[model samples]
Target chain A: MRRPMPVLAAGQVHEVHGEGDDRAAGLAFALGLGTANRQGAVLVVRGALRQGLGLYGEGLARLGIDPARLLLVEARDAAALLRAGLEGARCPGLALVLLESEGPLKGYDLTASRRFVLAAERTQTPLVLLRHAARPQPSAAHTRWQVASAPSLPLEAPPGAQVRPPGLPMIAVEALRWRGGPAGQTWHLQWDEQHGGFRDTTGSLGGTPNRNENARTAPSGAVLPMAALRTG
Target chain B: MAVERDAARHGLAPGMTLADARARCPDLATLPHDPAADAALLTHLAKAMHALTPSVTPDPPDGLLLDISGCAHFFGSEAKMVAKATEITGLSTIHALAGNPAAARALARHGTPAQRRAEDVAALPVSALDLGEAATTALRRAGLKRLGDLVTRPAPTLAARFGEGLVLRLRQVMGDVAAPLAPQPVQAPIRAEARFAEPIARTDDVLEVAEDLLRQVAAQMEQRRLGGRHFALTLHRSDGARRRLLVETGQPTRDPPLVVRLLRERIDSLADPIDPGFGFDAITLSVKRADPLDARQTGLDQSEETQDSLQALIDRLGVRLGQDAVLRLAPADRHMPEAAQVSLPAAELNSSVSFHLPAMPRPLLLFDPPQGIEVIAGVPDGPPLRLRWRGAVHEVIHAEGPERIAPEWWRQRGGHMGEGATRTTRDYYRIEDARGRRLWVFRRGLYDGMENAPSWYVHGLFP
Candidate 1:
């Protein structure tokens, strides 16, 4: 919380990546933050990977995003995906655009990203490029962040008597790059699925850290934590 | 048989034998007459006259009628315009100026070899009125050989002698009345044109002319409070070939720059680019489809401007790529997962379709044709423990549903036989795999001992 996160600007490109978990949570969070009070729809361009139906509703519900306002476009390749993204970004009725690609996106270079940035800026629609296990590449994006799923706090059960399901999922987020500001600041935040809001667990929870705690407690647990099995 | 001028002078007339003509003049020569060649030459003349005025009608057996009222001034005078028409057609043409089209046609056809006015139409032959054979015969028997002879007779007496049609024709050709002329069909398009003294063979010249024409068209549209959704540019080449390029916008627009940009894109993307061949002599642009567009007062704010820019972008893309390439998802009326939604062309989206969020979580992507899978459920009526898809097995970590959905049995065939009438009842499950991937799996058919064993399919994925 000491290093305040920069606000997502209208008509800017932001890239997000996740490690070893349902990568959708980061996209849901970005979508929720980018499309607040904008009078348009959200378009999701999912490249080659068939993003199944289950996680979207759950993730949007967790992030407090309205499913009715979301539009999904399944593209065939990187080029088509990028075109869909840039076109969606240029649409005035679109409040935000979330793009997810299967592999290293081809032809999405500095020049292409710059064109996307210009279109987004011209239309004042925010664009979020979500990737899974992709290499860091140069782009005209305003910021980039790496989001990894972190362990949630242990559920309340008699410590020596029995273990219960974990409370909520937490994430370790780092701003890898941020334009107009300093980058490389990491924060531990907890996501309230019911209310679809984020909390700074490290700032308010006295920095009780480490995702390994759940793994350590799961082996000897009677009620395995529900959050531990909430991946995918 | 048609005789040449020289042959006619040697005491020879058309329909006479060649032997007789040769006997009359030893040097007489004859050639076969082709009606098709005459028709084709007439058509060429008609097309050539199109440059002078768009309303040009063909009078068969060797004549052309042109409506040159407003356009005559362009060539300096009616006489000069006729001269230009004769030059462009490269034919021996006789033309006359009259207030009515029938008088003009008759005067040109039979009044004289050169220019004739409406007053002179009375001296022409009664046959020139183009009356029926019976009326002309009756007029000839009554010694009314000239239009003057017919006009001098009492109007009622003439009408009683020859039916009302003859009187009507007489009045029409006499310039005392008006007769509507049916010319070649011309769609009334808002258009502008540019003619070059010399033909243009370069793409830049074509684009420049197109830009000017677009400006003119846009101004006209603005004056009419209208916007054009479809535009066409016709390039008339010097070699008589016409090339046309048509561009369509996603929505009505009167912006000249946007129209020119779209035309440029269409020209650049053409697989067979324009080959000026002998160069274009004239270029014309027409607004083929227009819609009434009211003036929009946009505030000097970011949101409205952004919306305008976005609309411009969509129109540009629609011209470059196809309009179908841009799509928006619309909910369908069917209950089946695959039929529950459809992709509609964004430009032509049906706004009345209300979007309904599924009561249960539906997959973001469903297989076009649901892929079959092997399910290993531990219980007879429970979710699968493991599913094999694409030769890969996924161990189910958790399972959610047995949401039963029945087939639309009203449409089932073999209604009378219960054995054949039974349709598969689907049991959908939202399951998580060991690798943390969630899947939508469905069991088809039932194990009620009245049918075959059930099958499974992987329907969709969760993002």
Candidate 2:
């Protein structure tokens, strides 16, 4: 196991403990959140459709940052995603290219994927990849994350209403790897309904390994939270 | 005696024995009196005889007997009819008329075929009565010599005493009993023959004449409510040369337009060097086999949908591709695929059009013989796992059950094959490849049944 290093993407939520500089410092140490070491670059946010991107955007705005700094690119196919990456660097002020990887199965062979890795290296444009296959992909991706959402607590128990309830559920983002950041970390946060935003959590939800219930369900002793884990 | 000199030189004098005559003149040619040859000659001559009524009988060894009783009045009188027959034979032969066979034999043998008066017969000896030598000798000894003398006797006693031969001979010449000469049968082949007014060297000229003749046959067929399937076109040249072309329809049809089309197609290939002579003046159309056309069906509008006549297609295709190039497939008896069809050219396919055979599953792609295939399978009698067909390997994903089609056993026991040729035991299978390519293949023989080894062959591709 490695130390936890936490980073906030444009569409993510990070929690702080207590209040003032001490609380902020404790939260920063615990989450490993700090200013990025590199210049203008890509910031990949890993999760599923179950964990809404709207909630993550609210957390970044809480840090008094403008959402316009990130470029959201929904690339459906591999060719479209690859093109979008190179085009992001050409924009000069662009920092990130967000690609949604879902719908239908298509794969890039080892040779084709190596070319994408080399292209990213030559242009010095960091690349991010998301996968939705049943098994954990062993690939040339820099890091992997097991992300999912937590169950929503009740606000008002409606009468015969089947709509989505309030109090946006918490997302359990498991940092499976990190090329530049400290790895083997997990975080849980809830979207704040008062300010119509998401906020960082204050308490640790099992900081160490607990394998009996969660590990029995999680693959490789790592569980993500965005939607209920359905094993195939 | 030019007659005696010619007959003597030709070795045919009456008293000159044919053998003795052949010995005196070493080059003298003699033939056994061939009644068959004589009959064949009469048969051909009968074609020319059609100009004078259809009745003409070959008089066995020497002459022709025609029942021209009613026919004689048409040529004015007996003398003129005799003169006409003489003219037709070119006056080199003889003709006769009498009241009986005995009398006619006396007149025709002694007199020329040109002379019809009884006086020409009067000078002939009593031996010319065609009676036996004994009867003639008895008549001569009794001093009752001529037919004129026999006429004075009581007719009943003459009949009671003379044999049936003498009675029959007497009755034939007297015209008491008709000889009933066989009418020369004109075969009248299903042909359209036209002799041109001017010798036609051009193809167009022949086609024009053919069109007219076809129309005539078409009208005749319409009257009889019949349709002809086979027709021959004969072109008579002025030099007595003949060029004939035959065409047949897939279905019986008497349409002039179709006949004209077939003829035009045939005439298109006729070369110019086959020159028509000075001119032709006669044309004829004859039917070979007439099929009754149902008036009920043909009365509908002339559209392809209205009738199921194969003639319309045969005519259209036969014109472009030669008649032989178009063929109709007729099922024949045999297990071998090659023997399964009697592939007759469209023209020859018409006459023997009806065929009967039991229903069976027939292959659409029937190779003369099947091609061998290389296959790697799970086992013998098991479905193929990988088939190397047409220089490529196709992996099988799924296979259907075998549909066993047995060979027809009885039909194969003839011709050049002695015995070693074994019958095929086919087990057909439907197999699908991994890439979704479906194929129909069969195993030739069972694993241990009878063969060098079991073999697999791809027969067809299934969609």
Q: What is the interface RMSD of each candidate, in Å?
A: 5.7, 34.1
Off by over 4 Å in 2: A1-232, B1-176, B182-255, B267-298, B301-305, B308-310, B327-364, B405-423, B449-451
Residue range A1-232, candidate 1, lDDT tens digits: 1345334578899888764244644654466457755666677777767444322332243345555456556666787788778868867767788888755889989999999899998878888888877886999999888765554554454343222323454555677889876576565556555544455555444444444332221111122122221111
Give the runs in model 1 whose Cα sits over 4 Å from its true position: A1-9, A17-30, A43-94, A118-124, A132-134, A145-232, B1-187, B199-205, B236-243, B271-281, B299-307, B350-352, B414-423
TM of chain B vs. native, candidate 2: 0.50
Candidate 1 on B202-241: residue-level lDDT in tens? Answer: 9877888888888898889888888998999999999999
**Candidate 1: how close is chain B to the reference, as a TM-score?**
0.58
Real contacts recovered, all predictions: 0.11, 0.00
Q: Judged by lDDT against the true structure, how good is candidate 2?
A: 0.50
C-alpha RMSD values across all candidates: 15.4, 31.7
- Candidate 2's iRMSD: 34.1
Alpha-carbon shift of residue A49 in model 1 (angstroms) = 6.2
Give each model's whole-structure lDDT: 0.71, 0.50
- For candidate 2, lDDT tens digit of each residue in B75-184? 89988887777777653666667654445655777554444564444445556657878987877887876655665677787777665666566555555666555555
